[model samples]
Target: MGRKLALLIATYAYEDEGLRQLTAPGHDAVALAEVLRDPDIAGFEVTILVNEPLHRVGAVLGEFFHDCRHDDLTLLYFTGHGLKDDEGRLHLATADTRRTNLAFTSLSAEQIDRAMSGCMSRQQVLILDCCYSGAFPAGWLAKGDADVHTLERFQGRGRTVLTASDATQYSFEGDHVSGSAARSVFTRHLVHGLREGTADLDDDGNITLDELYVYVHDKVVDEMPQQRPKRQDNVEGRIVIARNVNWAPPVHLGEEPTARASAPEQMPLLQVTPLSVPTPVPLVAGRMRWVFRTGGCVRSVPAVVDGVVYVGSDDGALYAIDATTGEERWRRMLNAEGVVRSTPIVNGAVVFTTADRSLYAVDARTGALRWERLLGSQTTLTVGIVGSLVYVGASNGVYAYNAEDGQERWRNVGQGMTSYQWMVLTERLVIVGNTGSHVYGLPQADSGKTWATRIPHRSVSGPSALSDDMSLLYVGNSRGELRCVGTSDGERLGEHGVTGKAIYSAPTYVSGSTESPGTIYVGNDDGHLYALEDFSYERKWRFVTGAPVRTSPAVDDATVYFGSDDGIVYGVDVTTGLERWRFSSGGPVRSSPTVMHGLVYVGSDDKGLYALQATY
Candidate 1:
């Protein structure tokens, strides 16, 4: 491993009256330097310069990069005023920087780039937490009046740059005074992620450059939505930046204190079964109840139990919030690399899959790690829990594990099978649709393949929905076709074709008599949510949206709720297909809505978990 090195420069007090003094840079530099110098964490030989003049700062920057070996990992951080010349070139302002004489008094990006270009070290990182920090043009060539392109300024082999904001926004400092409020929003999150060991996104004990940037970006945006962090990367492979000082192997029951590395499967499996909880009263009308924000996009569908909402996010953590007040109860970071994108399955324990191909079972009440199991290289396709068994679908196969200890009981691999939706779990079988134009049903008692039904001219777009009596399965495919099959042997029952381009949304069936079969609601890429008669297979009503409705709808007593890519959540009457209420979120709404305790809980790409009023 190469030695780690860091150069931190913070300029706050300016000589020119035109440039206002900033209170956060000096504090930010000192705090970051301390964390970087820790031998157990970053282990970098850090040199910090506060309020330094242009000549001294420039000389040290050159020496810092030029003196490092090709194998060494070097990090450069700047927190101050990033001013642009009349020609739109970015310049880092120093203590003696003059507004009128910026080119001569301030450090130019060309000077820093030249030093970096001359360095032999291939592993280099630059972090800028300043205003207009992204205004550096490509190759130091001026793009007269063009938008700021920070990547263009530092795009090279083995180079990475992280900026606090894009060219159009200003970096934010919470307050102008020298106190706790003076912390720079961007730098504060960066330090917190590293120091607290949360930046180790994969939960693998090592913090990579990509993980750190994502963790920092999510936190910065969550705190300051107006500021969007940007990054430029040209590295060949993984670049480990630091070790997570606070990380430790998960401790399980029956494992001795010294046996921290024991495999999860080695522990005895317990019968941790889900409770038989009654459903809450459904809402008659909808209103905005409360909105809770997370560190990153909340694309994972939320699971509500016992007046609490459990959700996951790209920020790499599972969050539990109060259903009524929307206050955070607890959070557990799973894996930063693959983040919690799959919907969480909450029983006695909360089961979730990360993009990193790992499945974790945690305590539902307290968010404590119960057990973890590593899956195949392919990302987890879907996760489901029933009684003492947990079912997982991946690109490689379908697996069954003990819900309590994550012990694999059996696995059935099928060639070319891939799923992008949820797994439909029945009392006797686990049904799943695949993009390979096939559907598979596995016995719940074991991994025996029950049936394999194939579709023609289209692939299964999402998960299949079973009828209330569990006799029939309704599936939607990429060809805008809705196919019905018998759950017993996967026999084709009936089929209906829609004019929509593709059906990515899972089919949702409302309960009715066996003969009636209620209404089946599904969304497609054509921006319409189609309602069809279950037995007749005839279209009843269709509601249109501003964008594609890619998520499955959650039907309550009288209303159906779903989200759209247009950043809106809509509640339409179940029978009339007339809009009841709509809530606009900050970004796209991909997470499906869950109605519980008279509130509809949903996650948005804007990093918010919203609790909309549905009661009165």
Candidate 2:
């Protein structure tokens, strides 16, 4: 019988004071152990090493590799501190580590590579959840970020390496005392993609390294704009493992499978075809229409142009459907191993960045790939079209590309940058945010620094509505606090908290009474939809939903349409907070609803997409 194996090295908590500060407590080890112990993975041997005293990792690692058989699959994961020596060599810090005695306490990337070089099994994965791991000298680091030692010594064959950050960065720990030092932002999203099934883009049972990298890259950038992960691949050919396994789809409100329809009873049941009616005249009362459902989690805001709505899904596809009919006009498969978290930017004949870690110019009408340019190994945060340039943010940095050919124009790495999440484009500047709660303003001309401000809460999502005049910028944080910041000097206008729920979605703006000017609408994990009066920071009203509301809200005229985890899409009075109508779906409706042409478009976790009409 074939065996499966996982070896986890969590080297933070030990006698060595320096290493202890960097390693997470035992809980990190346990969490990883739990995943390795899953019934799905029971067939393989698992090994775990915590902070053992004195150069213990090498011997244990050697033993594990030596014992592995040809038919076994292996996963090697390490959670601790990583450093680069003076010579630019990557080293994994051991429990008894002392920076002064690198040779005695640290393990070099070359040593690990050499240890695994003789392994007969073709399916192996190496995950390093430590800072400075990108220094591993594999050809994975981009030109400027690569260290000379890594380029010369550590390259290996038939292996995939996933690192926490670039060579010069630090990996963080979550705030919780008992949790992993910092759920390597990359690992957290990788696990999410695996558990949610987005990593299996082709719907195959097993996930590929390519898919895993894309999933981790997109999710981490979406969740932690500050920390950009690095991926190194040096396989002679495509490495496929667990080829016959199927990944479960990520948990969404409407993802549940429905039973097949039953045949009509023998008593001559009449076939009822719903009558078609003439298209209703556009409501003169400034009412909005909610219509189509994507039946997947909606990550990006819907793009509406020329009566057609475009959006991306966790299902690895970009969908363009009729704004009124909810009928799919075309869906370009991203072929990514993860969900499309960023919204699609549509420009005439081209629609861009639904997924795949690249900026793709696709045929807007036919869903064909017109052109694709690999920007970096991170997810595209928020993309905007300004004249001839397409502005986008990825984990590695911010970039501007030619709107027509997707050519590189300019990129500005975030200053004091830990990670890059979302960016808002203003007339004179482009403002982007990081996980460290810092926001940077880059002048549009030379990408020169304008001004940088730090918000109170960490920004997990993108910035929204910097105002057409670029006066007030509205931003939300993971702590569920929404604030209006002055674009000029980054002065705090005011802030309001939506309970304690994290605001995972971007805030949307609606024109308030000419008196109020800017009213911000956003959703929270606390399952509430909120409307905040811009300047005064007063809570206009809040509507409670059945489940957590992580998707942003879409507003048109007087009504607001959004989806909730409760498996329902709601249409509510924007001013009164009254439910105008509610449509139940088969599963959760975590995706935001797009309102256009008398219809709302959203995707549920359920397998079927839906189109609903409001009956008065």
Candidate 3:
């Protein structure tokens, strides 16, 4: 078995009276030590020193590190006060560290570095939860953010460092939500990250050092906007810091997960798939590391373009989050009008969405309002952008507006077909349907309907999908039937029924790649997600979740991902229909999952939008 050892140093009862007395360091150390020593979390050999003498700090650290074996993992954690000496060197102040003679009394960063240099352990992690902790890197100060490649460049040396504050920022003492003598802001969240599932960004049950840093950094900064944590890594492999109690190591969702294992080596971040046309490309699965949050429920799937995540909230705001750090870039709000339930679409430099019965176009980078147009009524429908036109379906009608300005281009005000699911765009036509009495095909250049078909007893449930040859269009209906019709004419091709229950949304069409055969997936109120052979409508698999799955399904290379009203997101094998994993949200999940790059973005009625990493 590999050795896992950690030394915790917390000095709140400093001998020097001139320094401010602190209440958190002592408590923070005890709390975190308990979490780390738990068999379920870190299960480390924890040696805690609280208010120890200045002379003893150096000897103890050396004794701890010097005994580490080549394959052992060693961690050193400190909390108290951090200072910069006259020489601008970083020091961790001890209980007896006097301000006047700090150089002779305090332990320096170089001293720890020296002990670490001689250690045989291949993995070492340092966490400094004091002011100016970011200065722990002796020669690495004053450098701005490192590029993505920095982690790879430092791979050979498995030293990972995280600090509570940047060199210029202060480590905060958080508000006592309940009692006094509360933990320090950084350590409180740090403990929360280690002990709670909040820090498990991927829902994979294990929290990596990098993932913990992101979760803690965002939370600390959120509570105190002035403080920013910093992290530097030379880790060649993932350094898992803790395990979540609710999750086991990921296995197929219904199968037994393997015991938590060491962090695996990773490749670099996924780059954006370049846009050759204005449609989505099939996504390849990868690990996800972070999630972004908004003020209210996010019923819409997120739009990722360039490097930003454009998403809407029922709080009446359209937000842009940094795809890398999950930091808010900017926000454009609708000001108490209504919720923005429709997913946003990113095209060129602008992003568009529907809210409060109007269509809004905002600058993608700056979040400045580019233009706004009021439809007849408030809408939960998403707007479509093709070429230079913006199409919106509302209570009054389906209206087309010029994308350059808010000018109304055309309106087919009485077709009675409206839904927010999806709209199939073709080279020369736009086909859209809804849970109304009809489905319509209209010219891209005008609002004139090319063809309209009315169902005698059934209503279209969602949007439509065009066939590979662009000859047939596929749509679902509340009648529980999957219907296919000729795209050029109004001729009915075929229709198939499923459990005699109403289909809730649009069907997804997967074109057979060299690796997969074409398949179609649709969900119904019967609580089943039916997978059918493309063109043939032959049933392939029907997965059952006791609760209805009104949400649409998104796909990665090997899995079909969707959410259930039961508040869980399920990843199932596309071929075998075996569950791969399930992530629980706080409330019902009605919004569809959006798979992009290496993440799954979805929303819950619990007022949270989640970003989950792919797990096999």
Candidate 4:
């Protein structure tokens, strides 16, 4: 593994009276360095220098570059005043520097650039967070302005530079003297972005140079309007700035004392059995009971149970909101990671959620973390709970754990493939679907596979849905086809293909789902909600929308409620395929809703969680 190293320097207290002293930059260097040094976050061996003089900064630079190895990724960050001399030479000011004698008192751009260019480390990232920082890269930007094409100039190279603003603009910083939260406006967002992992555009667990710059640029422009962050990169391949904290390495349960002993000694492979799904409460629709706004995007469904609604956000917090008032009851943050897309499962007194690399079990009432089992790599997949066992599918393989105390029971490194890990479990079998185009049927008592069925033509789309009794499984593929398979032998019993577009959402089953028997609701990329009869695979009704329907539907007695990419939450009649009520959430509603006690709880990309009941 290549080594990651960083040097962070912030000179906040300057000697010049005109250069107003800054409070956020010094704090930023300390806070950011602390996170980088953590084994979980960036994991960089970091060195921080606050209010250091020019001589000290120069000495440290000499040691940092001279000791860097060829297989290392090195970062140099500065947060202080930046000025360009009359000859266009950028200079970083130190506390003892006099503005009149720039060459004698300050650190020159040539000094740092020469050192960086001569370093043995091929991947060098230089970040300037002070005023006029963007001037370093402004000379090469597209149209001599900041743009994507200009940003692309850094592609395919091993060297990159990032700046806070253009030469003509000043980087903004607020004086946060008293508040516990003190960070330079730019550094604050940068640290938060790197820590949260929400900046992973592809959700691949790694934040690339492009993704980080884009995230930071957008935030700085959005939050500080006057600032325009810029970047220049020469990275030959993807330069991973940080890994998502949620996808921690896997930990076996019996490896610790708090968990259970091990898997059962020896047992016969059990057959798949049916399980019952609870009925949804019928809501009248049209009136909002209450509305709650979170700090970030609410892209996951809200799971409502026992008067508490559980929802996860892009901010990486699992929130328990009051079902009656939409007020928060308790909240748990997922170890300073980014984005919680998995819908939480509330089993008994615990709320189970998969974020980054761990499957966290939190107290349902108090939002306290009970126990966390690491699932190797970055996994945003939802967990499956059957009886007292919790199953999670991760990048490494399939894992089973004891739910109560979080001990690993068994693990099967089946083909070692990645998964969204939306799984279905029965009393006897664990059914797993993956992007590798194979669905495996694992015996619940053992880690061996009973049968592996290949769904040729494409990968599995979203997660599979199971009938109440777990007798039949419904899975969709990237080819827009929906297949029904028998759980006992992993046999494909029937298949139906939609239009040309793929089905990104899972099939949801309602009562009477025997074969050709009960109804199944599924959303597809063709911007339609499909109502099909179970056994015969016949389309009963289809409601068309303006955009793709990647969010699963929540159905009650009379209505089908789901959101569309077109920014609408729709309530359509189940049988008639007619629009009953449509509410505009002001953003895309990809989060599936939970209907409980006549209240429909759902989340939107607009950062709002809404509860709707009948207007009458």
Query: Candidates' TM-scores?
Result: 0.53, 0.51, 0.52, 0.53
Q: Which ten residues in a row have the lowest lDDT in candidate 2?
A: 276-285
The digit string of per-residue lDDT tens for model 2 on 385-425 reads: 88888888877668888888878888887474587777888
Model 1, runs deviating above 4 Å: 1-286, 415-422, 514-517
The number of the candidate with the highest TM-score is: 1
Clashes of each: 3, 35, 4, 21
Which prediction has more favorable lDDT, 1 or 3?
1
Please provide, for model 4 over 1-616, each residue's C-alpha lDDT reduced to its tens digit, 9 standing for 90 to 100.
5678888877766655555555466567766776566655566777665555577678888899889999788988898777665455567887666766779879887777678767889888887787653223334432333322222322334788887765544566663333433676778777887788767666656677788888888888888777678888766777777766654333567654433233222211122221111111112224568889987788887888889999988888889999999889987876556577777888865545555677888888788778987776666376778777887767556788898999999987745354534466777887777766778888877788888787765545556678888888888888888888889898889888866678888889887733337888989887788999887778998876657898888888888888887666777877877766555564678888788888788898889998987223
C-alpha positional error of residue 432 in candidate 1 after TM-score superposition, expressed in Å? 2.4
Query: What does candidate 3's lDDT look like per residue over 449-558, in tens digits?
Result: 79877653455455566667887777777778888878887678888877677777667777887755688888787777889987678899888663677877898779
How far off is residue 531 in model 3, in Å?
0.9
Lowest lDDT sum, 10 consecutive residues, model 4, at 274-283
In terms of lDDT, which candidate is strongest? 1
Give the TM-score ranking, best first: 1, 4, 3, 2
In angstroms, give how far residue 506 of model 4 lies from its true place: 0.6
